[model samples]
Every structure is written in C-alpha cells, then in structure tokens.
Target: MNEENTFETHRPRLFGLSYRLLGSRSDAEDVVQDAWLRWQQADHASIRDPEAWLVTAATRLGIDRLRAARVQRGRYVGPWLPEPAEIDEAPGPDHHAERAEQVSLAFLAVLERLGPEERAAYLLKEAFDYEYAQIAPLLGQSEANCRQMVHRARERVQAARPRFEVEPERHRKLLERFMHAASRGDQTAITALLREDARLVSDGGGKALAVIRPLLGRERIARLFWAAYRRRDPAIEWRMGMVNGEPAILRYRTGKLAAVMVATTDGERIVELLNVANPDKLGAGVTPDPGRASW
Candidate 1:
C-alpha cells in the first residue's frame, strides 16, 4: 500500500487516540493533520511499521496540545465538557461495552484530572490496548514508568468517572423519559428520573446562556429544567440521537445547532447530565437530521 493509503487506513484509530487524549475534536484533527505533515516528509522505505510511527507522532502532538489546553481551560468560563462526537448508531450484539465506556463524555471528563503524558500513557495502554513496551517508546518514557503512569491514571479515572448504564436500550429509554419530562416542564416526573445526588453540568463557554456552576441535587436540577422549559422559545427544536456512543438530545435553535446533551445513568436514574452548549464545540462530528424530531 502507498503511504497515503496506509495513513488513511489508520486515520480513525489515530483520531480516536487524539480525541481521547485531548478531549477536543478540533485539537485531535490538528494533531492528525500535523502527523500527516510529518508522514509526508518522512522516508517511508526506512519505516518498518507505518502505524507505529504515525501513532507516535499523533501521541506527541496530542501531548503538546493537551499541555496548551490545560492552560487555556484553567481560564475557561464555566464547566468544561469534552466536545461531543457524532458516532454512528450503536453496533450489533457483538460490540464490546468497553468501547463505548472508553469514549463516553463522562469518561473523558474523568480523564481531565490526569496530566498530559499520564493521560496518553493510560489511554494507549487501557483504551487502545497497546502494550506498555509499545507505549514507553511512544511517550519517550521507560516501560516501568509508563506502567506507573497507567496505574495512577487508572485509579484516578475509576474513582471519578460516573456510573453509566451500559445497555443501549435501557439508557436510551431513560433519556427519552427525562427529555419528555423536561419538555413538558414536569418537575415531578423529572425528579423521579434522577438520582438524589444527580449533577447537571452545562458548558456554554461564555458564548451562550448557561449556569456558571454545576447544578447539584435532583430537586434543584428539576427546578432549573422547569424554569428553562417555561422560557422555551418556539423556534427551539430537539432531537434524540447518539453522541459519543451513547444516547443524547440535540437542541437546535431556529434550525441551527445549539447544544448536545448526554446523560450518565446508574441503571434506573440519571447520575449526571453533560450538556455541551458552547457553539464552538457542537458541529464537529454531527449534523442535524431533519427527519428525526423528538419534540
């Protein structure tokens, strides 16, 4: 295969690695593009493993972007959620639950607590199933050091990540109920569908109206949604779809995209609601489908 063909074959996995590392689609794209540039100038005949070389380049670029993003995120306006990706419909029965768990917005949020290189090491080993020996050279660290990074990062992620119901049908059903309740301003119904300690985070990035802090507690969240629905604009439309390999609500204003919401549920009740409202983060991998109106 030609260099371009080889790169194209590995592009999806490359983007997946970068996106998981940086938690931003645009940044991931930049990393992939930069890797492409490096690939174009490299001597392919001397490169025995094209995938390994490209993965190493993307990982390093992602690490650099993550370092810069950490500083920028420190000054961000409100809660920062990962940019939601538009994934295809859920796969068949043979699909692994781990794939969805690894890419969920909730998992990405947990990953934010780790340092850049640590995050890369952990993701490569755990999410992408790369061996520590393979990951050590990619991050320019010793194998033992890479193992430590994965261990520490794993502990932090496991402790902080929200519990998500893995069954797609069950998760979708619960989200449907919540959205319907929210649409009707049914505070009682909404409250019933939430865990007592449920948290709702909206990332508007100061470009739209959003709560400056996370709304805690099911009751408070219920009231907030009630108030929001009371002020709902006639032009606003909502659709139910899958984002980040999970069920989500896509909010559109005047036929333009506004926000994407995904709920993390603990089987029966929602444990967290991640609403990405920042305009800059909405359109990367998704487009509005005119046929599937949920509201």
Candidate 2:
C-alpha cells in the first residue's frame, strides 16, 4: 500500500484513542484530523509503526483539548455534556465514527467524575490494553505510578458503572422496550424493567425540562417521566437511535433537538438514564438520524 493507505489504515485506532480520551465526537474528529495532517506533513519513510505514533499523537491532542474543556466548562450554564453522535448498526462502519461510537454518554458522564490523568490512564490501559510501561511516558509519570492510576481510575469508574454489556444490537433491544414502557406512562411496567434504585440523570443545561438532580429509584423515575409527558404540551418527533454507541432516543420538535436519552441495563433491569437536554449544548453538530436502530 502507498503512504495514503498506510495512514488511512491507522485512522480508526487514532479516532478511538482520541474519542476515549476526550469523550466528544467533534473533538475526536479534530484530533484525528490533526494526526492526519501531521502525518501528511511528515516524512512517511522515516516513521515506523504508524498506528502507535498516531495513537500517541491523538491521545496527546485529546489531553490538551481536555485541559481547555476543563476551563471552558466553568463558564457553562446548568450542566455540561459532551457532544452526541449517531452510529449505524450496519456493516462497513467508518473508523472515526466507530471511535466516537464507543465513548457512550453513560461512559462519558462517568469520565466527568474523574480527573484528566485518571481518565487518560483508564482509557489507555483498560480500553486500549496498553501496558503500564507503554502508558507511563504518555502521562508523564513513572510506570509504577501509571499502573496505580489506571488501577484506581478503573475501580472508581467500575464502581460508578452499572454492570452491563457494550454490545450495541442487544443494547438496542433493551432500549426499545424502555421507550415503549416510558411512552405508555406505565409506571409498573417501567418499574418492573428497572432496577429498584435506578438513577435517571438529564443534562438540559437548565434550558429544558429535566430533573436537575439525578432521579433515583424506579418509582421516582417512573413518576418523573410520567409527569414530563403530562407537562409536555408540544408535539414531538422522536425515535430510537444510538448515541455514543449504546441505545438512545433522538427527540426534537420543529427544528431544535430537544433531548438525547440513554438507557443502561443491568441485564435484568434498566439501571440508569442519561438525558442530554441542554440547549446551549444543543449547538453541537451531532448526527443520530441514521442510528444503530431497528424499527
């Protein structure tokens, strides 16, 4: 293969690396573009192991962006949420799309609770399966320290997470059932499918109607959603879709995107709901119309 094909081959991994590190679709794409540009400018023959180099470059770029985002978030109103994107369940998926795809909103929301170093360590070591020694220099820490950081971050993230599979298709099925129950305003139906203490969190940035504090308990969540349906007087257009890889709903009315709801299941029951409803955050350009959805 030529130089173009060689670099093209590594694009997917680079995107995955950036998306995990930053948890934003647009930011990941930008990092990938930066890596691609750097590649275009470099002497291809001099570089060995293109994928490794690109991964390193993308990770570093994402880290830098994450730092800027930390500062920018302070100015954010209500809540801050990463941009959302759609994923197609069909074959021949693009690598960049796949990269943004895996960093689910549920996963990204978890990342928010972590410090940058911990987030980086977690993504690199856990998702990429990078060795401590390999990730050490990337984080500017000793190998031992990197290992500990990864271990600690993993514990926190895992603890915060509801035990679940990341399989997109199966996840989509569970979400469909969730939407159906929610739409019917069937509290018992919803509660029966939810964990006893399931949490529902929404990021409306205070621009939309969502529970500012996370709603806990199956009963409370069912009531809150039911209340919302009764309160909403406007006609809405929506459907099941994929956001950040897992099953979600893309809802809107007229022209503006109203909310993106993600459902997390613990195999037996739905455990969490993350609703992105912030209008300022709505400025982000994300596509979910062609989701990994089956109607």
Candidate 3:
C-alpha cells in the first residue's frame, strides 16, 4: 500500500492510542497530526513497519502531553473528568467490549493516577497486548524495567478499579432510575439508588458552576441534585445515551451541549457520579436518540 493509504488505515488506531493515553480528544488529534507530519517528511522507503513507527511516535507525543496536562490540571477548577467520546450505536471492531472498557471514563480516571511512563507501559501492555520486550524500546527502557512499570501501574489501577461488574442492561436501568429520581427532585428516591458512600464529581473548568470538591455521601449528592432540579432550565433536554461504552445522560440546553453525566454502578447501586459540564470538554458531539424507558 502507498504511504498515504497506510497512514489513513492506521489513523483510528493511532487516535485511539493517543486518546487513551492523553484523555483529551484535541490533544490526541494533535499528536496524530504531528505523527502525520513526521511521516510525510520521513524516508518511508527504509521503514519496515509503518504501524509500529507511527504508534511509537504518537505514543511518545501523548506521553509528553500527559506530563504537561498533569501540571495544568492541578490548577483546574473543580474535579476534572476525562472528556467523553460517543461510541457508535452499532458495535464495530473499534468499538468492541475490550476497547470500550479501556476507554471508559472510569478506567481513564483511574489511569490518571499513574505516572506518564507507567501509564504508557500499562496501555501498551494491557490494552494493546504489546509484550514487555516490545514496550521497552518505545519507552526507552529495558524489558525488565518495562515489566516492573506495568506491574506497578496494574496494582495502582486495580486498587482504584470498580468493585462490581454490572451487566449493560442492568447498568442502564440503574442510570434510568437515578436520572428519573434526580429529575423529579426526589431525594429519597435518589438516595435509595446510590450507595451510602457514593461520590459525585463535577467539572466546570471555572467557566461554569460546579462544586470545587467532590461531593461525598449519598445524602450530599442527593441534595445537590435536588437543588439543581429546583433550578433546572426548562430548555435543557436530558437524553439517555452511551458514553465510553456505558450508559450516560446527555443534558442539552436549547440544543447545545450542556453536561454529560456518567455513573459507576455496582449492579445494585451507583457508587460514583461524574458530571462534565465544562463547555471546553463537552464538544465531542456524542448524541444518541432518546431510547424508550425499557431497554
């Protein structure tokens, strides 16, 4: 295949890798574009594997961006959540269960805790199934060192991972009930749907109204939602959709993106609620139809 066709063929995977590593669509796109420019200027005739070369370039770029982002986010207003990406309605090779799990907001949030090199090693090893030996060269480390990094990153991620695994349908049902309760300002109903220790985080980027810290406990979360409902805008429309392969509520104000709310459930109840209201992070354009009450 020609260089142009080869680059186009691997664009999605490159973007996926970069997005997972950076947790920002814009940054991921920029990394991919940079890789493209590098590719254009390189002597492709001497390269044996274009995919591997592109992946290495993009991943390195993403790692650099992640390091900068960590510092930038420290000054961010309110809790910061990964920007949501809309998955296709029909599952494709790129939107399979494994890929979805890797890109899930919950997974991305946990990933944020790892150092950039550790995160890169973990993603290359676990998400992309790259061997330790293969990852070592990309990260400029020995194979054993790469293994150690992956091991450490795995322990950290597992510790913060969700405790329960709820089926997709059940998760959606729980979200529906939680949304219904929140919409009606039914504190009792909402509290019943949340775990006693459930936490709610909102990211407003200092440009909008959001709690400066995570709201802990079911009571606090329910009260916050109740207050929001009381002051809810009539023009804002809430629709059920999929975000990061899980059920989410997309709130639109007069047809413009307002907020994207995603929940982490443990089959029976929600343990965490992430509300992304930052206008800067809400431009991915993931809109799904308003499905019926029943799945």
User: What TM-score, computed on C-alpha atoms, does each candidate reach?
Assistant: 0.92, 0.80, 0.92
Q: What is the C-alpha lDDT profile of model 1 across 195-292, one tens digit per residue?
A: 99999999999998899899999999999989989997898877676787677777779877788888888788999999989999976786445454
Q: Cα deviation in Å at residue 52, candidate 3?
A: 1.1
What lDDT would each prediction earn against the true structure? Answer: 0.86, 0.72, 0.84
Off by over 4 Å in 2: 1-4, 43-46, 87-102, 165-174, 232-234, 255-257, 279-295
Alpha-carbon runs more than 4 Å astray in model 1: 87-99, 162-165, 290-295
Candidates ranked by lDDT:
1, 3, 2
lDDT of 2 by residue, 32-135 (tens): 89888887888878878777677777778788888998898777655566667443322233322232323777777788888888888888887888988888
Which parts of model 3 are misplaced by more than 4 Å? 87-99, 287-295
Q: Candidate order by TM-score, highest to lowest?
A: 1, 3, 2
Global fold similarity of model 1 (TM-score): 0.92
lDDT of 2: 0.72
Candidate 3 weakest lDDT stretch, 10 residues: 87-96
